[model samples]
Target chain A: MPKSLVSLLIVLLSVLFATAQTKSSSAPSDLPPGSTSLIDPEDLLSELQSQQGEKPLVFNVGPSILYMQAHIPGSEYVGATSDKQGLERLRTRVKTLPRNQPIVVYCGCCPWSHCPNVRPAYNELQRMGFTNLRVLYLADNFGVDWVDKGYPTTKGQ
Target chain B: MRRIVLVIVVIAIAIAVYEAARHSSHAKGHPGAVDSPAPQFSLQDLDGKALSLANYQGKVVLLNFWATWCTPCRGEIPQFIEFQNTYGPQGLQLIGISMDDDAKPVHEFYQQFKMDYPVAIGNANLAESYGGVLGLPVTFLIGRDGRIAAKYVGATDMTALQQKIQSLLQAR
Candidate 1:
């Protein structure tokens, strides 16, 4: 092949690879099983209410606005996990806890499939060697799945 | 004494039923009912201009609650732009209330999408007023009379929304 043609082909291939990487990274479903084990809304609520066994540390990784509007009572806000700063905050927050400590992360910003926060946050915790971690499955956003269902929620910052 | 007791029992039952019905409706997170007056609010748009439902009264309004990061909400913008262009002459007004935590991304998204409609940052109070915008892409169709004609949760069907808008525009 001509040198110019070869160069052009390489450039096109690079562009395609970059595009694929971008798309895959943005998709929450693309994460591995470590971040995929999900706790259903009702089940999580039941567990929280049950007060049996070790109480899991719940974290809200959605937008601050949504968190302020309504969030699971006692769930700490760690910012939107999709952002770099938010991920860093999550790392700092969990660094002192034991690896086996039960932790739950959730972002009901959008639909489960399109959520931009939870998977990233879950993966970050998994990377940090957290053994007992689960993602709260909010099929719809927080308002519909948790707030509207009459699940306990506290508003404000 | 027996007649008074019967009346008391009837009143108690009526109150119970009314309370149950009210709680049921509130639990559903549906504050805006069809044919009811749309909640009114005055907010500042990105450009610091005043945007209010009252300002758009006597015109059909398509009020959309969305965020910049929401994929479905992003998908609906172009179609909304098209709707504004196609229906503005007929008194169809599209208003966007972005629920984004910050306005920076919203401003970038607005420019990137070339959104023609006035967009504002919405707070918890505004979201609650519109039956709690718990989810993105919730849309409300307001008739010329300023009453809510329809409400759609989640990503909406644009064709049906357009049809509804057309009908609403024809009313006044």
Candidate 2:
């Protein structure tokens, strides 16, 4: 089979898997409560296109290099949640924004299951009572889901 | 007519750029086995100099893949620094392959740790060559002969690492 077809299959599988997780009786078990509001890649892309003025604040809680290479347009880097400085940056970033402001967090440096940055960042916002938070499901990485799709991308830190 | 021609030209350029970027982005499969020869790479160091793996041949090279954000990687750096101090003159070469994307934070970490070795920006391609470095603080010990000696996936033991380096340094 062609490589493109295989890649599309993998992306499709990732989307399906992320959607399936929403219906699981139990959460990931390891992750915290209220961490399952996953924003599908297609859905997020569409939202970015349609919503102009009231766009949600997107945060790339991944590594600096990934952000520098490419990132969802308008997303801010608040450091890696695995680090003390990162968590503090997140805490500071959320202070000015309204508690109900729509927020999406992502870190496609690793697989979603093993990503050290996303969950902690997600849970931290949740602990702060930010109900309008969602995770951008990056089963592979940002390059595959977002960048490869020709979505809005901005490089440089 | 001119607008249509312009559109076609733009699309062609876009496709060419996309294909080129995609082809250069990824490498095929793993870089090979531990016993096999190590991949030669030139990566930018803290001082913006090119540090090459092959440049350190004839010395036992400790190629460490680490991130500033990783807790275990922080703990392991002290040992590496100590090893470099003790065995650097004895033909042990330590190179840090920082998994961090930004050099600013790593520079601060380097100063905090007081590291004396060269640290390069690590990429997925290089990590995958060492049999897929999925975790932090993964290290590869390269023999003086330029073949991989051992690959450690987590926080490396000081005593064991020292012993291995000692043997490699003394081996005829």
DockQ of each: 0.23, 0.09
Q: Model 1 over residues B1-172: C-alpha lDDT tens digits?
A: 5565587589989999977975566443356767678999999999999998899979999999999889999999999999999999999999999998889999999998999999999998988787777668788899999888988888899889988988888885
What 10-residue stretch in candidate 1 chain A is worst by lDDT?
A: A27-36
TM-score of 1: 0.81
What digit string (tens of lDDT, one per residue) describes model 2 on residues B1-172? Answer: 5565587589989999988876444333335356678888888898889899879979999989888766667888988999999999999999998888667889999988899999988876676556445445678899988888877755678789888889999985
Please give the lDDT score at residue B158 for candidate 2. 76
Model 1 spans > 4 angstroms off: A1-27, A30-36, B1-30
Question: What share of the reference contacts survives in each candidate?
Answer: 0.60, 0.09
> Candidate 2's error at A22, in angstroms?
26
Evaluate all candidate structures by whole-model CA lDDT and list the values in order: 0.85, 0.77
What TM-score does each model's chain B reach against the true chain B?
A: 0.83, 0.80
Interface RMSD of each: 13.1, 9.6
The residue pairs in collision within model 1 are none
> Candidate 2, which CAPRI tier?
incorrect
